[model samples]
Target: MSETIPAGKGISAAQSKIENRLIETVVESFNKTEDPRLKVLMQSLTRHLHNFLREVRLTEDEWRTAIDFLTTAGHITDGKRQEFVLLSDVLGLSMQTIAMNNQAYKGATEATVFGPFFLENAPEIAIGGDIAGGAAGQPCWVEGTVTDSSASPVPGARIEVWEADEEGFYDVQYGDGRIAGRAHLFADENGKYAFWGLTPTPYPIPDDGPVGQLLESVGRSPVRASHLHFMVSADGLRSLVTHIFVAGDPQIEIGDSVFGVKDSLIKSFETQPAGTPTPDGRDLDGKAWARTRFDIVLAPALT
Candidate 1:
């Protein structure tokens, strides 16, 4: 069937009707919600969605196709995975939100979008321990300090860390619970923490949706830079979700398919001995990798 709108179909009039109905539905739903945040979110989303439809002069067929794509995205999701987060990442919406909310940390430590693969069960390890579990990749020791904005150490802070293996795959991606290149470490009494993990590598976002099509259409690559994800929390300090990008990783400058790259987030990954005993207390020599120290300074909570 030809997917063209029929002549004299009153496109504008139809759009007006649909838009009015949408606004009414949104207002009704918002009124039924008690959460202030949800109300703001729903109202803003409704206004923007309506504006977008009107601006684009969307046709019924296109809207239906879009809905179908979204449905398929949901269908593709299962335990240990989320296609919606993938969708958000590909559209750059995730990074945009992180950037907007982290504006206060611009000069301090830039934030990036957390991908869908981070799992909470990262094995806990001591300082100088390895998160690589046992993956083949460049050996890198990541050390850093967790502190408040004033540069005072926040000892006993918990840092949740995870990254892809040397082969550019996370534990979830591998689907084997290997937990390679992932760990959770606690800051010592000095607020200092360090661990070893395989240096990250550029990897592609899933490319099987409208978002993927959008990236291809724009002549963009779906690769993200090598980086380690970190979520740090401590008493009396605001929590932070951030990443440490490998400096000089070509992907950092060009291939962040999610638009999440920032100069401030990049750090040098220095060469280290390969014979470094694996994080498991076993001697594994000749494992070449990079090392870097990253310090995170958090903002004090507003009373």
Candidate 2:
């Protein structure tokens, strides 16, 4: 599918006037919506959509092609794969929606796109346990503290962590049943948390469907910056779904296909030679490992 709408001379002024009248009628029809928020949403959506159609003088053939593309996207979607999320990510709508919803608080960790790979009910781990669970990669020791914007420890905060293995394939991507490179653990009494994980590597978004074809037509790469996913939450605190990107990953400068990177989210991973004492004393069997710290600060809930 073509990524850009073909440039047109735009609709004539007379056509635009008639289009505006239709937009008015559509907006008025939504005024009867019982929910005020729904009413505004429908009216605004109608206006913007009509405006877009008019602005481009959208051709019937192009519109039909778009419909066909979306139909194919819908047809390929399933429980394990979400084509719509991929569409939104490629269009930058996912990141834009996240930005619009996540308000900034003093020194709180910034949030980023929650990629569609997260699964509910991940296996639980103790405060200082391994989340790797048999995934393949260089061992990494991840440590962090969960705190509020005021710098007070938020004990018992639940942190969900997941990442792709060294080969850039999430466990879910394999046909065989396997649970690896993902787990959740709660903060200790002082808000400290630690776990063993694989060092995150750069990977391409699932670009095998309509979304991929569209990107190729438009000359965009589907690779995301190397990073690890995190979702943190505690009572009365705003939940955060974000990622900590590896510092000095060349992909960071190359760009993330989903536009999920932030300078604040980047951190260094200290390299440790083989046989270095593991933080939680789990032996790596003579393999080199890495360590990184992420001190997370969450904002208060919007009441």
lDDT of 1 by residue, 1-303 (tens): 112222233567675665667666765667767898997788777777766676677899999988998888788787777889988887778988986777674235556788888787778999888887877777677888887777788899999998887667777877776667778889999899988777778888767666677678789897888788998888876677888888888877577877777777788887756665544454545656566889888876542
Candidate 1, residue 57: the lDDT equals: 74
lDDT of 2 by residue, 54-88 (tens): 67777999999999999999998887778899999
Question: Which residue segments of model 1 deviate by more than 4 Å?
Answer: 1-36, 105-107, 273-283
Top of the candidates by lDDT = 2
RMSD of 1: 5.3
In model 2, the Cα lDDT at residue 163 comes to: 94
Regions more than 4 Å wrong, model 2:
1-11
Candidate 1 clashes: the total is: 7
- Worst lDDT window (10 residues) for model 2? 1-10
Q: Report, for all candidates in order, the number of backbone clashes.
A: 7, 0
